[model samples]
Structure formats: structure tokens, C-alpha cells
Target: MTRTGPVEIDEQTQLAARLRLVVGRLHRRIRIDGRESVPPLQLSALVTVEQHGPMRLSELARREAVSAPTMSRVLSALDEQGLVIRTPDPNDARGVQIVLSDAGAAKLAEVRSHRTALVARRLGRLDDDERRRIADALPALEALLVDED
Candidate 1:
């Protein structure tokens, strides 16, 4: 059911709203703490390439849920920064594949390490019970990302 007024909001709706705000704030905090030379879109693309390995431009665009032209621009910026290498696709001679360069991997690792350290420090300030509660919630948090289909 949908509520037209705040007077009738449901528990689930309130939980969803609170979770979204907290997650967004945490994400922004991490990004601010781990600000890198690469822009957010470009960094996300780089991470995708790293996860999926070398893939054709079309495949990368599809995985990233972006148009080919948009992906192309992101790749171009990464290429200019020497974060990604465009190599001729062996399977499709006419196509090019995107590969994460050594620099890209290092940058990703560095960003993650910084963010993790920041989180660790913050978590350290919490009481043991609070810390355990968050740890226990990990499974549920991860489950939230599962695709329902």
C-alpha cells in the first residue's frame, strides 16, 4: 500500500528510506576520503573492466548500462590517463577490447585501501556490541544486493 501522507507510513518504507540515506552518506564519505585522480564514472568503468577482464567495447558498455558513445568517452579518458589499454580483439579482428592496465589496478587498489582504512578507524571507535551488530548484519546487507530475478 502507498501512503499519501506521512501520517500513515509503514515500517518497511521507513526502513528503506533510512537505509538509502545512510548508504548514500557512507558512499560519499568513502569517496571523499579516497578521492583519486580519476573521475567517478571513469573509476567505475575501470573497476568494471577489471572485474570482467578484457572485453569488447560493446560488452563493456552493456555491462555498464551505458550507451556505446558514453562508454567510448569514458574509455577515451581512461586511455589518456594510461589506466586502460585498448587492444585489438583477437576473436574479432575489427573490434577492440578494453583491458585494465597495471596503473589502473594499482589505482583501484590504492583507493580501496584508503577507504577501508578510513572505515576501519571509524569502526574502531564503536563499542564492541555495536561493532558486533554491524558484523552480524553483513549477511543481510550483502543479501540486499542479490538480484531477485
Candidate 2:
């Protein structure tokens, strides 16, 4: 059942190595293009709030792999920047929720739009065949992130 020469395994390993490099480069490029007033980590937290609606300081901290106190500081900065607001949690009257302000939403949108435009411009330079190849790989490329572990 097993074939000799390690062709399949070798090819897959090489592909994985190259893919990692390319993905990292692309991420760096996007980040550079999307630079905003907020730091990257804080921007990520803001994006999380926008994506998942309001969340608690502890919940956001946990999701961001940071301590609650650290998250509180981040939230404080965001609050000062008018990027987030504290609202009373309806279900837990004693708790507060962190919600992205309209300004924060606009900022996030602008950053993402800039990043997307960067990629779109790069993609436009590729030939039709190369573009099609990238497009054809979308499903398999997307599947890689489905179950990371």
C-alpha cells in the first residue's frame, strides 16, 4: 500500500514550508498598509468587539489571551480614544459590557478596506492564469484554517 521514494510526503512538506512564508509576508504587508492610530493588539481587540458584539472585560481578555487587568487597561485606552463604550450588561446588572463606538467601527472599516485594496491591487497585476490558480486554491487554502489543531 505504501509507495517508496517519499514523493507525496516530500512535496506536501515543501508546500507547507513555502505557504507559511508567503502567508507571513502577506500578513506583514497588510498590517503595514493598514496602520492606524491604535496599536495592532488593541486594534485586534476592537475588531473582536465589532465582530462579536459587546463583551465583558474578562471575556475579551480571555479571548485575547491577556489578563483581566491588562484588558482593563486596553479598554481604558480605547475608552479614552472614544473607540469603545461601557454599557450596563442587561443580563448581569452588576457587570459592564465593552462595545465598539461608531467611530471605532468606522476606523476598523477603514483599516480593513485599506488592507483589502492592497491585496486587490496586487492581485490585479497577476496574469489571468495565475489569478485562476490562486482562485482555484481558495477552497483548499480556506480548509487549512478550519481545524487548526
Per-residue lDDT of model 1, residues 86-122, tens digit only: 9999998898999999999999998888889989988
**Candidate 2 clashes between residue pairs 3 or more apart in a chain or in different chains:** none
User: TM-scores across all candidates?
Assistant: 0.89, 0.87
Give candidate 2's total backbone clashes.
0
Of the candidates shown, which would achieve the greatest TM-score relative to the real structure?
1
In angstroms, the error of model 2 at 24 is: 0.6
Q: For model 2, how does the per-residue alpha-carbon lDDT over 38-88 read when each residue is reduced to its tens digit?
A: 888799899889988989998899889999998998999999999999999
Off by over 4 Å in 2: 1-6
Query: Which 10 residues in a row give candidate 2 its minimum summed lDDT?
Result: 29-38
